[model samples]
Target: MNTATASNFGVAASAGGPLLGDAEFQFLRDFVYRHCGIALSEQKRQLVQGRLLRRLRALGLKEFASYCELLRKDPAGELGELASAISTNVTSFFREMHHYDLLVEQLLPRWLEEKKGGGRLRIWSAGCATGEEPYALAMVLAEALERTGSKVDARILATDLSPQALEHACAGMYALDRMGGISDERRRRWFLRGEGRYEGYACVHQRLRELVAIQPLNLLHDWPMRGPFDAIFCRNVVIYFDKPTKQRLFDRYAGLLEPGGYLFLGHSESMHGLSDAFDLVGRTVYRKRVS
Candidate 1:
């Protein structure tokens, strides 16, 4: 078929007629929004046609509407598969390094001082695809604490909606080429080069890996953590959510944070009309109101 309309949110509008194309796209769009609260736009039509065509052919279902019917009925675990196909999982080690730099330069000193008073340090990495960010945070924590001889208990919760992505994060392996922008010293200290069967990859060192616990979590679903978290890195994940969802999510983040705890969102994301419980600290960084 002609693969023209699919976009980032998975489903696209049908360019042609009402029979198969329109029905299939509508089915997918509705299903995704119902499950994840993501809004599908018309610009994604070509993308939907392109990405899901192979599946349609493989199932020997000639008409796209057939797929729609199956999804509408919520057929046997297929919805999860569709979500996996549509969710964007792009990530890397040390992405947008300034955040990490901020952590090291500003946050760590304060964290260390807090730890001296027996404060428990907890960091939540929401939308932590394949575990890179949490592990990186762990490395920073370990290095800083060790240098100061501060005995502080710290843990990172690395969560994502994709179980497959969580599995990759738990495995702690990544393409060596993806390490290009990471500093050589950081790379050498935190990652180990794979050998033999996995010769082309690099894996996070055990010390850092042990600090992060990867779990499957859908942001749109009810959260399971009991927390007054010290910091939360919810970067680059809310751009797809609708206004109401974003507002609700920010409120939830506020509820879980400790007094004066920090919240870090994506570079493009803001709390403009979302929540007033936080004070903007910097670009995409917010400090929870403490009184």
Candidate 2:
């Protein structure tokens, strides 16, 4: 769900810096489908053209064909950058406050009570961009553990496709400006404000980092973990995917979730006609129906 921007990458390219042509565009369209599970339409051609320019410039290539060749040679390596070129990863700490509200107000307390005797409690941040979402989850989970004095073996699995994003997530640092969604009390509790040369940034507390395991994952590919997770947060990720892809993804989620596990979607995303494994319960919140 996350892609690496051009700023951090250097690619070599050749001559004739013309616009992205038909044959090359078609190759990209087909390639995106095969690798990324996205169906690029004619309507997106202009937008793709504009975005590809950034990739080409970042790669130091003048020709779109050169970029295509790069993809042909190393599709897995370049796929993330190309995806990022096309769609920016827009995420923030507590981006959708309501989702956190559900976790804080109901889910956390309930789960802690159930697992208090050192039982495992797992939650997955399916497309955790740059660590915000999972770290935020850690904050609440930490508080819940202390409040109830629970002995739960709790952890948050934060994963994304973009290597850059996962690296940033691993760093667990953020500019102070990005702390808008975090309240002053929580801020003081969970973040270490940077000073001197590191001024204007905040590093997540070591405790929070321990609760989150950051990892690289492309949802379209095979997953490495077998889980009966209690909840999964995959917000704002599948909007670009076609129906079949979405359907299969939802099915897979159903497979991994604990019976009656929760699935939270993005504000604009819906499961209507896409999945019947879960029942809509709250604002974009779904519960796996125990069969």
Candidate 3:
């Protein structure tokens, strides 16, 4: 993690305690998991408290339970807004560049040459926040498909639990500053620079933008997409889930994947004890083995 990220985490930890008591923390934990498929751990106590302090104060409820009750009874966009408020949606263009490199250089070629039956390729970016990962995937796919001369159709399903996050993802707009590590050529090819009042920002091109379908999907809830995805990029989202929830989640992911489909998880996450359904494929990648 960078210095800024570490500082943010540190400040969040310090700022969280008084806002949420032990019982409130537990309630928040359950509520988050129940709604979003994120399992909170003991280590997350500070993080949760820190991230949600604003919500606690804004709701005018002194206790977590009271706040939760308000959320439940909220008839408007309250529940969804609550998830949006507490959820962390930090993302950047090509944040984990290696994963995309692996896909373009290695996986695409292998899949094209070897696979005989299905000419359709599906990729799911579960918990895709503000659309960076899926957009990157689309660019890589377009490039790879151009090179291979294969007519196989490709689609990217980008889903997040937060309505606010999904709204941003659909907009496909991002600050140019956030494109720090992205190359100049890619920026020129895939993004349109902002003008007038919106100057200094960039938005994805319509073609690349069309490749992704954004939706508000709670991973903890029933999955709406019927997928035997060629790849599922569900990175960084599961780090907050507890062991049991993680295990069950892995199983569900396994079920969604085509036999031999790939699963890429967060850098800090491991499948060590999660499930027997997948074969480790290095660096947080797993292959859903044909049964």
Candidate 4:
């Protein structure tokens, strides 16, 4: 779709569309679950309909059924679009502050001790939306490295299902107003303020960006990277997944982490009945067992 045409279609979609029917909702729900493991409950019917209206209009399709048909026929190309449309990308810098506090106070300290001589530190920010989580992690790790004067090599792998979000993440830009959680000293050290045309924005410094590798990944599928990571931050991600899918994904995370590596979940999530491979070490935090 050309830029001009796509913009016009988006405007038209905002005007209104036919209501999403039961069959159409069920089709999309199943397709999303099977492909991305996001279980759209019956409650989210309106949400699904609202989010996809733009896509339907963008494709010049009048009905939800037509959109579904296009999805099935062009799974590779269209599935990404569907994922972008349906997935939520709400995030901010230093969100869930306690997790970062724990990282600085306990996790990094212990991990640094474990690699006393010199070693690499790897962290995976699964479902990192719009870069904040991974960037915040980068900032924390960088500070720890500087404070402890450790020669440890630190890197973060930031992955998400949405290509659109990944693009924004790679750009590493944010509105100036979003800097509230950041302190004056840290802001001065880590981000470059925008000028003239880019006023009211800030970009992450080159050094921090270097520490992170942003990529598109669907948690439902096989991961491309091999890892015995020190930590995996999958916060607020599994809320959309069903029990079985969540269980399997948690097991996979356990397998990927080194023994005693950490898994940080969202505030609303827990591993209570999901997996026994990890033991609760703190609120919403789990530590992998050697066994």
Top model by TM-score, which number?
Answer: 4
lDDT (Cα atoms) of all candidates against the true structure: 0.79, 0.87, 0.79, 0.88
Give the least accurate 10-residue stretch of model 3, judged by summed lDDT.
8-17
Q: How close is every model to the real structure, measured as TM-score?
A: 0.86, 0.91, 0.84, 0.91
Estimate the overall C-alpha local distance difference test score of candidate 2.
0.87
1-291, model 3: which lDDT tens digit per residue? 676875443433343344455566677677667766566677777666655667677766565567767756762356566667666777877877788888988998877766535577889999898888889888888777778887677788999877778888888888988888678988998889999988999989887876788888777778877787989998988876788888988999999998899999988889997799999877888999987
Model 2: weakest 10-residue lDDT segment is: 5-14
Q: For candidate 4, lDDT tens digit of each residue in 63-121?
A: 98898898789876887778889887788888889999999998899888778677779
Cα deviation in Å at residue 34, candidate 2? Answer: 1.9
* C-alpha RMSD values across all candidates: 4.4, 6.4, 6.2, 6.1
Which candidate would rank higher by lDDT, 3 or 4? 4
- Best-fitting candidate, measured by lDDT? 4
- Kindly list the per-residue Cα lDDT of model 2 for residues 178-207, writing each as its tens digit: 889999999999999999988999999999
Worst lDDT run of 10 residues, candidate 1, spans 11-20
Point out the higher-scoring one by lDDT: 1 or 2: 2
> Which candidate order results from sorting by TM-score in descending order?
4, 2, 1, 3
